[model samples]
Target: MNVLKDVATGVGLVLATPVHMLGRLVSNVWWPLKGVKDEIVLITGGGSGIGKGMALKFADLGATVVIWDVNKKGADAVVAEIREKHGQDRAHAYAIDITDREKVYALAKQVKREVGAVTILVNNAGIVTGKPFLEADDSKMVKTMEVNTIAHFWTTKAFLPDMLEKNHGHIVTVASSAGKVGVASLADYCASKFGAVGFDESIRFELRKMGKTGVHTTCVCPFFIDTGMFEGAKTKVPWLLPILKPELVVDRTIRAIRMNQATVAIPRFLYFGQFLQGILPPSISDAIVDLFGANDSMDDFIGRTKKD
Candidate 1:
């Protein structure tokens, strides 16, 4: 009888797993956006471009939004827009450098006291230097790593403790599709984004080991956006790999977080490409990249001029 009972339990789980997954797939399609109301959402680099767009969307959903940016002016502008869309209390802004570990922790404490525990943490701050690896300045490379990759570590450390304490929180990383594959002129930027992708994967496993079922992680890897950061990037096949729009990225990101998606590649083409990387030979992969114009997307690069 004991042996029969154990067998029955194992069989039941095996049968239920597929049913549960199917149900979830249907639910995601039918009822996409969930949770998020009244949650405190903290977004780094929330002043402009994709960050600013996400802040507005969060406010529209009734979440208390916090914007953190090195450029205080840009953060303030976002807060102002949130206020107009929702109300004064719906949004807040802080001027702090996420690359500075000490400052990130300090601001986290302040935000906890003034706003509330951050229920959703978005590590979206990033920078790029569009130049060949040999011509790239050493300082620019270091800063790229600092802002694009290291900042995620510091921000997650500062806010993750509270989330773990409650066993309920979400961490979202805005990595790039460049993180998935190498680009000719974006070597430093690609390396930092690759780090971001690896970091998120490790953190997700850590949560699983700790048996923290309620904590969720979402990592987004998208192609270059039309945001000023990648002003001149273009695809050889526009329909296949067009530059992403900020609004589209923001919409997908918010939906992914609400639905607890683990990882998403914008347009879904990149997902197939990443799969091919594992099976295809190096020469074939290089040919595919060339055929798609990924090799020359940055030939006329002129990144954002203003420091913001």
Candidate 2:
């Protein structure tokens, strides 16, 4: 009876999968955003680039936005701008070294006391070293991992308690396309992003196992954006994998969050690319990457400054 019941359930879900997906698609189109507006959204690395762009959008939607960045001046400027445009209480900024776990915890406590429990945590802080594997220094590689991957671990540890307590919150991880597929000249970045994608998937499963269904997570993997971080990178196939724009990335990201999507690949083509990677032989995958110039996209890399 147990085996029969289990098989029946499996068959039911398999049969219903398309219907369920279609319903979800309709809901996404019809539903007004169910989050934000009175929620406190904390965005790490919110000084510039994608983080800053997301901060503005969150503030526009009436979420009290808290920005954490190593650059005090840039964070403060963004906070001031958001306040000026969206009213004084709509935004706040903190000079936080996200790489430091202790500081993350301490500031999280302060944020809870001051700004209220953060309901939306965006692990947006990231760094990249565009040097090839052998050419990249130890510090650069370490910093890349610390900022892009380890910071996700720390920030989630800090803010996730309140979220779990209420069983209502959202976590967003801004990873990269490198997380899905390997790339030359960005070995460290690829590793860190892959780690992030894995982490997000694991935690999401943990949440489900714990019956915390209300808490949602989204992992965003975008292609190269003109955000100064991947400054001189180029895509050989513009039609297939053109460099993403910051605004477009943020827009898609916000939509994903609003709809409670698990993971989203920018431009949507990467979904097929990931599918190809899964079944193709290693040699064929490598040949495809070489043909697409993804392996050499970072040949002329000039990444952002340390302070940025």
Candidate 3:
């Protein structure tokens, strides 16, 4: 009986060898490595805050980066710094408004021609006007949607064909944690972000269905960030949901993009908030939200306009 048991174990090991080998082959083929050195990466709104942070990180990692921002001077400055640090050919800057579909398509073509095919696209351009729903003008609401939500579609449509052709690429959508929840004085902002989150998730699902698994999508949902974008905004839970630093956020986001993870939430606790919203009683959840001052915190919001 002991001899029979030993033989059975040996047979099991023999069968498992092929499975182990297959797993190793997949990892070797797909895992992040130095091969990304020559790949081109495009980051929208790359002149400041989270977008700039991501651009710098990618450039540091040896990928050729393009800074696409509406702020021509700011983008040029970032490009200068990158070129200074990484050599002149490592970085480039383009001043383009992503909301303009024609301009976005033109820029994508120009990037492909000049910088090589864009292997990574970061949709990070967004705007937030902290006006109550009733107080928001039609123009303000339209501009908010155009910049925050529609730009994603325009930019993605412009560059995704190249990714599909290559069958390898990453799309990173820098959405806010507010995308997952509704708050006061930010109805427009919340709607736009939520739309972005949905867009990223849907694209991911479609890619999986199409068997284009090599093309990865990551939706980053982080709480208030210390990017000076939300300068005077109050924090509901400073300890639990401390405003994330741009560097830290960019680091985690890069990790997620490298790993091809589906979604990334900063603080990790925000996942619990999502779960609680679904399970708790409406009144109890409402009371908790109110107690946390989630709605009222944006009342004093002083955005990047106040910054130099």
The candidate that achieves the highest TM-score relative to the unseen native structure: 2
TM-score of each prediction: 0.91, 0.94, 0.87
Off by over 4 Å in 1: 1-28
Best by lDDT: 2
Candidate 2's residue-wise lDDT over 210-301, tens digit each? 99998999999999998988888999999989899899999999988998989999878898899899999999988998999998888888
Question: Per-residue lDDT tens digits of candidate 1, residues 13-51?
Answer: 999988976875686577656768889999999998999
Model 3 lDDT vs. the true structure? 0.86
* Candidate 3 total steric clashes: 0
In order, candidate lDDTs are 0.91, 0.92, 0.86
lDDT of 3 by residue, 166-256 (tens): 7988888999898998989889999999999999999998999999977889999998888877877887788887878888899888877
Worst 10 residues of 3 by lDDT: 27-36
Clashes of 1: 0
TM-score of 1: 0.91
